[model samples]
Target: MRKMLDLLSLKLLRRIEIRYRLINSFLLVSMLPLVIAGIVAYRESSSASQEKVRIFAAELVKQVAQNMLQQIEKIESSSEELAMSERMQNALAGYYSKNPAERAAGHGEIIRLLLENYGSFEYVNQKYVLDRRHRIMDPQVFAQLGDGVARFAEDAPDMKGRPYWDVYSTAAGQNSVVMLRDILFKSNNRVAGTLFVGLRPLHFSRIFESVNLGYGSRMLVIDARDGHVIVSANAADGNAPESGLVVAVARNVAEGRDNFVSYRDGDNKQQLAAFAPVPHTNWMVVNITPLNALNTEVRSIRNKIIAIGVLCFILALVLSFIIARSISLPLKQLVGVMKATRTGNYLIRMDYEGRDEIAVLSQRFNEMASKVHQHNERLEELVAERTRELEQANHQLEALSATDSLTGIANRRRFDEALGGELRRAVRSQKPLALMMLDVDYFKNYNDRYGHLAGDDCLRAIARVLRTSSRRATDLAARYGGEEFAVIVAESDSANAMQLAENIRNAVAALQIAHEDSPFGCVTCSIGVTAVQVDEDMSTDTLLRLADVALYQAKALGRNRVALSDPAGATG
Candidate 1:
């Protein structure tokens, strides 16, 4: 295994190119920063989202608690008024009187008072008064108290003048809360009867319904004293099961503090819950929401972030390939060219026309190859005088090839090659380069009036003027096409370029070439000038296009005029 690992390492080190290594390094370093930023952002967003959910749930639970307290307060207030009533005290005071008709009238009067004062409340489902002997007053007014109330009375036999709350399920499987209050006889200041107010869980359910706790969330009112659920709304499809989680949360909240928790239930479902105690009662309002339901938005944001990260990684990979190729391809070509030259092939040359140091090296290499080829030719010929004659003839042939046959000036091919070189030089030196495109005004009319030979002579005269105007070795005057000429000036500003263009225009007009059909009466040329402070992003084609645009503007304004292109307006 050790030998195999060594062999794998050797193979990787031997086969990987500098380009691939650079790309791998760039991707590794770039991905770490991106990953770190993504993790930090995700952690911050998740923490913030969790905190917001907790706050919302706690506030909702508090609101529900407030509403329940209000309802309970109304009931307690009504119960207190009835207990303190003079008629209720007088009735209980005369309950054992020998006059049987007086006892019946007192019970009827108490029932009439209950219906008149407390009947309008929607949450008051049942109301009744119990005497000291556990005999319910007006028994026909309410449903049976059932065996639960009898057991409750036996448990609390003292019947202290205080309110007691209990939750119990009826025979119909509906839950209800019963508020039992002790009634006192005012004269003796002792417990005389009990005022019972039974509330259906449906009334509390309506309170929960008023709040929107999202999907698959529930609200419960729990009896803090007994850990019993008094009211559970939207807990399930039909009847909500009294799960262990619900009981645990209720008991935990009954410790007299508002709190929130996240836990999994017996069914392996994640739950989020917040609880608050209802004021003036031994009850707590709990808002329980499923974790998956609340985390939907969070999950979506996570997925979107992951997608963006993947797209960024892909873009980085593409950029790495582009940057690596830009560096490696030139070196590879140089290696090939050097190998060719080693085999006695001196004609091979690098065509890279960039402002980088590599391009400069390639140009020097080509120059060295030319010198070597010339030296070898001189050594083989042995006659120095004949070699000199042949060299001069070669130079003449080279010059003729670059010149336009009719105009005796540089041709379009030579002009294009020189422009590329000059553009590279300008970038390296950080100097300006200017281009001028000129057209002979009404030259076609001249050809129509004179013969093709006369027209050729006319072009030759115009080319001479352009050539004389561009006197510097760095400047080039070329016949771009029929009746159009181009000039390239290096290390010059816009002002200098405009001056040279005007000089060429004036020189052409000074030729005094007659054109009878022309609008100008004499032959003239329109010039378009464009100058640029060269940079890597600017190309030869871009400069040509800008100069051409200026030429069009000059023609549009009038003939034989010079128009300069705005560099800021030029496109890439």
Candidate 2:
């Protein structure tokens, strides 16, 4: 009874240790790499999102600034045209050269010229001139806006026949975006008068109306000179917090950073901001959007990675427990089989169903024990046969590992090996070699239109074409990666490589795979061809790089065509 209890305790302790070791080994081996990959992917994806937002925001703000410049430039141009006229210049010099009564007497000519020139222009909501006496030439036109217009001219800088823009609202509820310019005399270059022309608020409204900056977004036209906001699209000056947009805009205007991005907008929320300077004016257009709003895709990727890691963790734990129990039980059985074989019961075998190392060891032991004395003469022949079988199995396994299972073509590992070997042989023979890289055009759209299973079939079909096309013994066709295939031709020059590439492109297009998403109404490919006379200086990496460059050129020029690399390592 003591022996039985001791044996039971020993088995229990061994099982516990085995379970602990298995769980620890599996978790460390699997989860550690997964955790590292998750972290790397998350950080890279985050950085990419931030960069994309920065570029997009910079472009959007630049477009807005350009639109605003176009509108303002039109107003400035019209006012300059009116002010540059000989009659208008004479009328201004005559009015400002006289006393208040005489000026008032000749001001009718100024008003008549203003009415005749800009009166018919619908955008000219308000037009007048400010003189030395602060008198309004058209009091009726100025109405409740006279004081505001005069103050603007007083506060504005000295304009020597140039336009200055201001945004204001009068006490009588008249709002105008007015342009101020000085009418200079031809002889003395003195300030004849200040021209005031106003536009409606809706004039600047259309510039910001069409832009969608997303939720919790803000768009402001900031004066670059003084860092004050001229107009806001979705924000109001009085009610706004003035912390987020104001701070970012202040930085943008101060630093002249048109591509500034990724900052806390002072609302305790992360935000992305960009600004662009408006041409012909000292103003900048700023666009600010919440980081979370722009990071939705990044967040989704992160969450999916986290979920996959968690699921893997749980599955690993459960699998560890199951594997531990299975191993422990099988080890006990294997011991029993060994004891029976020691007593000459060689027929006893372990009934294990696994492909692990333990299974292989047990199978070897079973075969050795069963054939120990039964076939002494035939043992040598049997050993020879098993050795041959093992070699054949190894060859099959190696081939499987080097080939892409989905496409039934040589995989990236095999492609790399082939390329290296081919370069060496070419260098020895001083012969030229050609490489072609082919990509299924618009494959992502194709997969989105069809299912992934169909995509796999499509790749297999392409691989069949590659297999048939490269008929030479020295030629190798490989699946470089998803939707990308490569071909290596020995003793080939650039012209032949290009011809082969064209053939491949045409063959792919002729497949007639219905791809509604593709422009050709059928599946097509783009091929990049590069051939170089192998020398001691040539490397596989350089060849692959050249081929990739040519591939990008093919994509740039248009798909469904082939591009060959030039001698200067550019597209031919």
Candidate RMSDs in order: 42.6, 31.8
Q: Spell out the clash pairs found in candidate 2.
A: none
Candidate 1 overall lDDT versus native: 0.77
lDDT for 374 in candidate 1 is: 95
lDDT of 2 by residue, 1-572 (tens): 65654454334434444546566656564656555776787778777877876777788898998899888887788777877788777777667663544555467788898789778877667778777655567644434567767777788876545687766666766667778888767777776777887777666856888897564567777666555667777535432333455566666657866567556744577877788878767767878777777667766776676667767566665555555555666688888888876666667778764555556768988788768747654777889999999999999978987888788889988999999999999999989999999999999888887988899999999999999999999999999977889999999999898988888888888889999998889999999889998787778888898889889999999888899887575331
TM-score per candidate, chains pooled: 0.42, 0.42
Clash totals in order: 0, 0
lDDT of each: 0.77, 0.76
lDDT string for model 1 (1-572, tens) is: 64654443333322454446565656564555555665677677666766777889899999889988888887788788888988788777666555444676677777887777668867676666777766667644224554445555546544355677666555556655878888887777788888777787777788877787674577887765544567877544334343655666655656754488776765778887788888756677877778777666656766666667667666665545555555566778898999988778898898875555567778999999999999988877877778899899999978877888899999987999999999999989999999999999988778878977899999999998988888899999999978899999999999999999998998899999999988888999999999999799999889999999999999999878999998887765
For model 1, where is the 10-residue window of minimal lDDT?
5-14
Q: Which candidate comes out best when scored by TM-score?
A: 1
Error of 2 at 321 (Å): 33
